[model samples]
Target chain A: MKTQSILLKQRPEKTPQNSDFEFKEEEVSTPKSNEVLLKSIYISVDPYLRGRMRDVESYIEPFQLNEPITSAIIAKVEKSEHENFKEGDYVLGHLAWKEYQVAKGENLRKVDPKQANLSAYLGILGMTGLTAYFGLTEIGAPKEGETVLVSGAAGAVGSTVGQIAKIYGCKTIGIAGSDEKIDLIKGKFNYDEGINYKTTDNMKEAISKAATNGIDVYYDNVGGEILDATLQNINRNGRVINCGAISQYNKDETATGPRVEGILIKKSVKMQGFTLQNDFGEKFNEGTKKLAQWLQEGKLNYEETIREGFEKVPQAFIDLFSGENKGKMVVKVAEE
Target chain B: MKTQSILLKQRPEKTPQNSDFEFKEEEVSTPKSNEVLLKSIYISVDPYLRGRMRDVESYIEPFQLNEPITSAIIAKVEKSEHENFKEGDYVLGHLAWKEYQVAKGENLRKVDPKQANLSAYLGILGMTGLTAYFGLTEIGAPKEGETVLVSGAAGAVGSTVGQIAKIYGCKTIGIAGSDEKIDLIKGKFNYDEGINYKTTDNMKEAISKAATNGIDVYYDNVGGEILDATLQNINRNGRVINCGAISQYNKDETATGPRVEGILIKKSVKMQGFTLQNDFGEKFNEGTKKLAQWLQEGKLNYEETIREGFEKVPQAFIDLFSGENKGKMVVKVAEE
Candidate 1:
């Protein structure tokens, strides 16, 4: 059978361009022992993948030049030579950006289509949802009556973070790039208020206004001047969870902003950063179960900006920088 | 009897000046029912007190203009009406900048001058010592064989932090303003290596060279270019304890440097700040006991830069900003 894959043609200097990715056609190889052949169904395109394009040290390894780039993908098993997985099984794995590939069955987790759609596993039930869950609960640790502020408010993780914070009995405020996103977060995500960063001239004043009691917990996704502003208005003993830095992901030079040590010392604040697999590997099952329960009980809601086609993976990933997508951005490679 | 006191005459714009303080002479007040008359023996001049001079909200109250400024002081009970304290008893309390003053006996903690020097309570056995102990243990959490880096290495808290890190069996590196300070830290504080930030052209390179295995824990007392350099060289899951920001304490405007959210997110580092009384009120006895035991066991050594005479109090404080003191900067108000 024929297969299609995306390779890192050139490492991105700043924002990713279509030319940085190479599309290739190849023959699909049969599965070896304890391996299963997977056909990509829903391919996740995330802001964090931008970091893998650079040749620098990070929590996760960087993507080597001319190699296939990989991320969280929902795939259907076409052929299985393993005891744990059988034909027609839907599995989730950190697989390559390919239409068909063979992977060890141990690397995949089975997902049920009857409980939720196949695409939900790539969004609300996968790493995106788990990322929001653990980062807010473990690090943010918001108490009742406290105020929680979230950046990238309309994105997948940020939207989920605001909902969870509200469920945990805290007031929620969000910061986004567009007025439309502001409305989406406030109206649909149960956020009490929202700030449009593109229109606001003074973020510190804006944050102070929205967070009347001061922000006790801040879930930061877009890092830069907005982070500085949030730090300025943070209440005493505030917590900041650095889930992602989408705004700085595309910068060529090291971004400069106001120093935070003074503010942290003054307010006795805690600022922490994390990745899901590295920090929460032991609690992943617990996180996934809780998130699934929230969805089933109608306590959770999610949005997906789907780009259909094998050729649109790079474009979908690049659109994250421009804030073109509303929530989780994914590409639909093929029908089941 | 006559006594002298200092008042905060003006809010300083940058570095504090002698004119910012006013000296006044008056008669010492007699003790009331439960009050005791204290004759100041030693006073602690710390970098954090600079924050109090500003008319801004902080962990502690801002100093009132034309009012007596207060700090940690070792005093002898000259007269007492309370049953707990008597004449000649040495007590440690956050007291006003007065040679002789009356205070409620309940606010002071008795310090045995026979166990250690009366002046030792103002340095290694008081807030300065406790700050290093808790900040390093609670936040830094340096493991054995890990590399620990400390800024403001020659100051009271930094020197103590290096000594404690050494006792914890960690590789320690010190960053100070001069080669003399570097020598003091390396020889007396048991620091494995030192970096003269003043002479070093590239601090990131300097840190990378000294900490060949990468800095696992960074105890930050001076926040600025040095902090940014330290963050850049931090290892994965590194810890940063924001004990002080002496470099930024005197700034008129908010300091700006390279944004750290990128490094923190990529490395999943933790950065936190704290004040002793507010964060660790219940742990005071525990920290003090451990610090005292270390001193008694010969595992801890302290240096005091004492300036005698009540008139030199303001100058001694101003000198802290210029890195004039090698270790704990204490003002000797009167003989014990």
Candidate 2:
């Protein structure tokens, strides 16, 4: 069978342009023993993909030019040679920006479409949801009655972080770039308070107004001035869970370190950064199960801005840098 | 009877000059009910005294001009009107820089001269010892076989920090200003290794060499380039206990923030600063009892650079800024 894939034509300079990615057709081989051939349904576009465009060392390796960008994808198993998976099983795996591909069945997990929408398998029931779960509960250690301030609060991981904080009985405060995003997050996610950082002249005062008791957990998705403002409002013994620094990820040079880090000394604060892959291995199933339960119970809500076609994957990824998406950004390759 | 006292005449512009202090003679009053008259035997001079001189908000209140500079002192009771203390008993309390002080019995804790030298009570058995114990164990959280690095390694808190790291079965590396202090720390305290940071042009290379396994716990006493270098060498999941930033304390303005804090994201490091007073009320007895036991077992060693007379207290305190003294600096006010 023929499969269409988006290959990196050139490495990105600053923000990625659509011309950097080239679409190519390739042959999809028949499934070998314990392998499956998947037809892609949805491809996830995350902010961390920006880090993979650069040559610098990070928790994960950078993507090479002339290779297809790989990410978590929800797909349907068109052919299976594995005992655990059936021919028509819906699965989730690190499927490249391709319409179809042959993958080892062991690398893919079967997704339950009956419990939740299949598209969610690429988002809240997938890596994005797991990232928020471990990053908050383990690193942030949010206690009941604590105030949790999440930057990028309208985005994929940040939205989930705020909802989880609420589930744990914490007062959730969110910071987003646009007033519309802020309103959606505050109104939809039920965040106790929301700040439009782009409109606010004084971030510290805005944070202070939202967090009257002071922030106990700061889930930093944006790590520039917003992080600096959050630091000033952190109470004694506060914890800062740095899941991503999306603000500085695409910059050519290092951004200035936050001036208010001195608060870390005064408040005896702890700042920790982690990748979901490092913390949750086989335990990702545990996260998905709980997230599915929450979704079925109507206790959690998520949104996705879907760009059509596999060829648009690179543009979808680039849109994350421009803050063009409201929630989890995904490229839909095929209809359910 | 008449007693002599030293007072802070003026706040120093830079290094404390002789005119910064004034000596005065005052009448010594008898002890009231539940009070004991103490004749100063040994007065501790520490780095924290510099913060007390400035009129700034801090964990402890700043010292007022024309008032005696006060700190922890080991004294002998000359007369007692308290049921808990007797004449000739040795005690430790916060006493002014004077030959004699009438203090409430509740403020003094009895010290044994037979178990350890009286001067050790000021350094290894007092607040400095407690700072090292709780800061390392509570904040640093050193694990067995992990590499522990301490700056200002020849000073009271740093020396005790290295020794306690050894007790905890960690590979201890000490950083000091001079070769002599490094030699003494390694030879006397039995640290795994010692680095003379003053002589090393490349502190990053020196730290990398000393901490070959990478630093797991960084007990930061001296903050500046040394702190910057230590941050570069910290392993993943490293813990930095910010007990003091002696390098930046004497500066006129806020010291420049560290450039390598970006490493916090890569290494997932946690840097937390604390004053002993914050944890003293709860962990005081536990820390002191452990230190005393270590002292009696000959497991902990302390060095003292003692200057004679109450008149030398200000000079002794000033010497700390210059890093002239080797271990704990103290002034002998009178004979026990």
Show model 2 residue runs off by greater than 4 Å: A8-13, A252-254, A258-262, A280-290, B6-28, B54-56, B252-254, B258-261
Runs in model 1 deviating more than 4 A are none
Whole-model lDDT, model 1 = 0.92
lDDT digits (tens) for residues B1-336 of candidate 1:
888889999998899999999999878878999999999999889888899999888988899999998999999999999899999999999999999999999999999988998888888988889999999999899899999999999999999999999999999999999989999999999999999999999999999999999999999999888889899899989999998888888885556788888887888999999988899979989999999999999999999899999899999999999999988999998998
Could you tell me which 10 consecutive residues in candidate 1 chain B have the lowest summed lDDT?
B249-258
Model 1 chain A worst lDDT run, 10 consecutive residues: A250-259
lDDT for every model?
0.92, 0.85
Which candidate number would show the highest TM-score if scored against the true structure? 1
Q: What lDDT tens digits, residue by residue, belong to model 1 across residues A1-336?
A: 988889999998889999999999988899999999999999999898999899987788899988899999999999999999999999999999999999999999999999998889988888889999999999998899999999998999999999999899999999999999999999889899999999999999999999889999999999888898899899999999998888888886567888899989999999999878888999989999999999988888898898999899999999999999998999999896
